[model samples]
Target: MKKYLIKKILSNNVVLVEKNKKNYVLVGKGIGFGKKKGDFLEDPKEIEEKFISLEGLSDFEYEHFLETTDPKIIEICNKIFEMASSELKENLNPKIHAGLIDHVNLAIKRLKEGIEIVNPFLFETKLLYPVEFELAEKAVSILKENLEITIPEAEIGFLALHLYGGRGNNDKEDALKHSKMMNRILGHVGKKLEIDMDKYPFDCQRLIMHLRGVINRVEKNQSLERSFVSKLKDEFSYEFKIAYDISKIMEKALKIRVPESEMGYIALHLHRLNSYKH
Candidate 1:
């Protein structure tokens, strides 16, 4: 049973749950609508177990049990709860909070076992990358059913905060400023890591979202900024110079421009490292 904290009760047995008040998805069940906000959805484990001992169960029944009543789904729900508790933003709109938590919970379930991602700087989500709520919802659905990988919604905000500050801070006015920052880091990663930033497994669509949001200041963005380049040089430890040098390779393969913003991104990581030293 996926234990959800109900956010809103829709008519016709459809209810929305705010898993961590970050992401929301609709739950359609007979009992879902009656549950009040902050109430936990009944555990699916008991329901699943009841179906297991039955003989000659119909395929449809078993499919439904696997989808909705599996114990493993409950375990995934719990893991998502942990991530939401640790990573969620404070003071979120209830709808957004619910969506984010639900998204994370579902995402962990989708990941293929032993899918190793090697990024010192950020958590790489393998799912469809979304720019807004509508896109996120649509992507979440596609990912939940089809793909076994997904990106968490708040990762962009977290990376932004790491490089700059809080959501309430420079996010509104500082556009080009961040573009420069991400470009540097991308450049660094391209140069130093065995991981390919442009090819599959580490494909273009995902990287583009990270680039425009975390490093560059672009609206309707689809590529990296200059700042990401700088991150590799100053903050990479032994990985710094190697990652810093790879900007040229990325630029050539991806046909993306690396500007002053990349320099700024590099500087921010360097500054952070320097501060940590003293």
Candidate 2:
């Protein structure tokens, strides 16, 4: 059996352990209880399923986070991760641990201070990742049950974004940047149409879905071939102009060129949204 040497105890339920010269954070109920550094865990099976690899992470930074963060918050994050893994049927990116804990801790602090949390991309996030959004809803319930505090829907949206970003090989920072760019593009569309998107949830959802698809297609170098590009430009000059501007915004943020055909599709969506305004 592989033995683990206790390296550090973060909490009664969490510990840093070393095996084969690699470190991992072992999380389980009472895993660290009555344990100290240099102690050997003879049975690897005891924490076989609960260890998070610390590879590719800064040890100092992670240790500092565990030391400073509330243990209750860490426990909650672990619970959420376990639930997500079970439901998604896959292991999540362990890098999200520290980030989620920090985010939740700050959100709780803000709530205590009576500061309102708002998510401008709530609709977009939900539309983009329905499964993650559902998981986040469950996470909100977990937070409320444990902390005795109500988590706002805005926070749920943020949580969904985090969960979605943690899946597969997704980079959390890149996911967040993509969401921010989508928000900015929507903001531009709202400004150009002189309408508040919040008032039209369906339209906003459609636009966001289309934008996401456009982004995926553009990143994969897939361009749509449309015969009516000139017709779209001539018929909806105003909407096409706004779409062109949005393409530029996307190009700058994504560092990829937005095809004119894609701009035509965007213009059609814009036209539909503008029609709803009148």
Best by TM-score: 2
**Candidate 2 TM-score, true structure as reference:** 0.89
lDDT of 1 by residue, 177-208 (tens): 33344445454555445444544333434444
User: Alpha carbon lDDT of residue 116, candidate 2?
Assistant: 96
Give lDDT per model, in order: 0.39, 0.84
TM-score of each: 0.26, 0.89
Writing each residue's lDDT as its tens digit, candidate 2 over 100-189 gives 877898899899899999987777677667799999999999999999997789999899878987898877567667778878888888
Q: After superposition, how far is residue 84 of candidate 1 from its true place, in Å?
A: 8.0
Error of 1 at 19 (Å): 19
Off by over 4 Å in 2: 44-46, 109-120
